[model samples]
Structure formats: structure tokens, C-alpha cells
Target: MKKIIKTTLVLLITITTISCGNKSEKKEADSKKIEQTEEQQHSSSENSIQLNNGNPWMANIETTQGIANMKKLMDNFSKKENSEAYTQLKSSLEKEFGTIITACTMEGESHNQLHNYLVPMKDYFEGLASKDILKCKKTYNELNKHLAEYSTYFK
Candidate 1:
């Protein structure tokens, strides 16, 4: 009787585990699908930065100031060679980003254009917090390039 009871319990546990695993697998697959869709959307041409009649787009004062502040933060951070300083720089940059978003007064196509340029910046900022110092350095260089590109696309 004890052997039968033990067998039954083991089978029940296995069945429950299998059922939960299937459900989680399905959920994970669904999540991947959504992420792919979003990635496609972001990568689309409409989200890309383009010039207005071959001239740089006019950026709002707040947005321009925020970018400048972030650039300054990056400059200071580059002088320091440590992960902790990079993390702090990331925090400061995020705060400046928040200020830009809060003070945004842009409208219509200009606003859309600004968003196209700004959306990918968050990913670069996220990379700054990486555990790998080499990754952080690469991200920093990419972020610097990204910031410099702002002038090319937006004045």
C-alpha cells in the first residue's frame, strides 16, 4: 500500500510539473513573438531619423539642452575609469532625459522626428550599466557618436 501511495504521489507531481512547464513555454513563446513585433516596428523606416528638405530638423530648446547636459556628464564620466562612476553617470543622464521629456513642447512632425532619433538612445544608456567594463566602454563610445549625430540631424 505504501509503495502504491508513493507511486501515485510521484506521478501526480510529475504531471503537475509537466503541465506548468508547458504553460510557461507557451507564455515565453508568446512573449518572444511580441518582442519581435516591437523590434520590427522600431526598426521600420518611419522610426528612422531623416532630414527636412536636406537640412537638419529644428530641435526644441529643452531637448537640445538635455542632450548637451548628457554630453557633459559623459565627458566627466570618461575622465573617471570605474564601473561605479559609469553607473552614476547613467543615473544622471536618465534624470536629464526625464527633464527633456517633461519639458518637451514640440508638436506634429517635429515631435515624431525627435522621437525617431531619441528612441534608440535608451538602449545605449542601458548598456552603460553593464557588468563588463569593455562593454561599458564600447557603449560609451557608441553613445558619444550618437550624441554627436544629434547635431547632424537636429540643430
Candidate 2:
């Protein structure tokens, strides 16, 4: 009787442990599913910003054009090395570009998104205009990373 009782008790504990582990696993899987669902929803909303007439190539071209223009502006600022003027220029450019992105992302695909995306590129140039080259480089790299990430989502 003693032997039977001990075996039964051990079996009961084993079963209980197994059940608890299964519950925790289930909970983790459910949580992951919820997170994935939310990400999908957000992506869908962002993708709703259709390329003008569904032309991805044209959209890419437009985006490149704006980037090129901002690069040119940045080059000009670097040549001047005027910190105060560059700061003002950078601020205004950021504002204007932000407006364009907001308008494009809001609804109705517009040239505005391309414009806003250029703001950071302009910042990169303006940063070079400052005395602190390292700081400017860091900021420029960070901005580029953000733009790369944002572009991936749009694509």
C-alpha cells in the first residue's frame, strides 16, 4: 500500500507540472499572436498611401529627386560653414518637409511625402556646417537610418 501511495503521489505532481507548463506556453503564444496582429494592422494603414496611380517606379524616382535636391542644399551649406544660418535653414527645411510627409501620409498620395523625407538629409548637411563634425556625423547617420527604415515600410 505504501509503495502504491508514493507512486500515485509522484504521478499527480508530474501531471500538475506538465499542465502548468502548457498553460504558460499557451499564454506566450497568444501574446505573440496579438502583437503580430497589431503590427499587420499598422502596416496596412501605412501602405494605404498608394503610389501615385500605382506606379512604384515613378514613386521611387520622385523620392530620389527630392533627396538629390536636399543633398545639393546640404553641399551648399557645407561650403559656407555658417552655423547660425544653417541652423535657421535646417529648422525651416524640417518644418516644411514635415508638412509634406504629414500631407502624404494623411491621405491622397502627394509630392509632399517626398519633400518631408528630405528634411533629415538637409540636417545632415547643416550639421557638417557646424564646428562639431563628429556630432553632425552621428546625427546624420541616425537620420539616415530612420529614413531607411521608413522607406522599407513604404516599400
Model 2 lowest lDDT segment of ten: 56-65
Candidate 1 per-residue lDDT over residues 52-118, each given as its tens digit: 8899888899999999998888777654468777777788989998998999998888888899888
Best lDDT goes to which candidate? 1
Tens-digit per-residue lDDT, 1-155, candidate 2: 99999999999999999999999999999999999999999966664433545443134543444444444444554423344654655665565455444544333344444444444466565664466646655655565565454443343
TM values, all candidates: 0.71, 0.39
Taken over the whole model, the C-alpha lDDT of each candidate is: 0.87, 0.55
Worst 10 residues of 1 by lDDT: 76-85
Error of 2 at 8 (Å): 4.1
Native-to-model Cα distance after best TM-score fit, residue 155 in candidate 1, in Å: 1.6
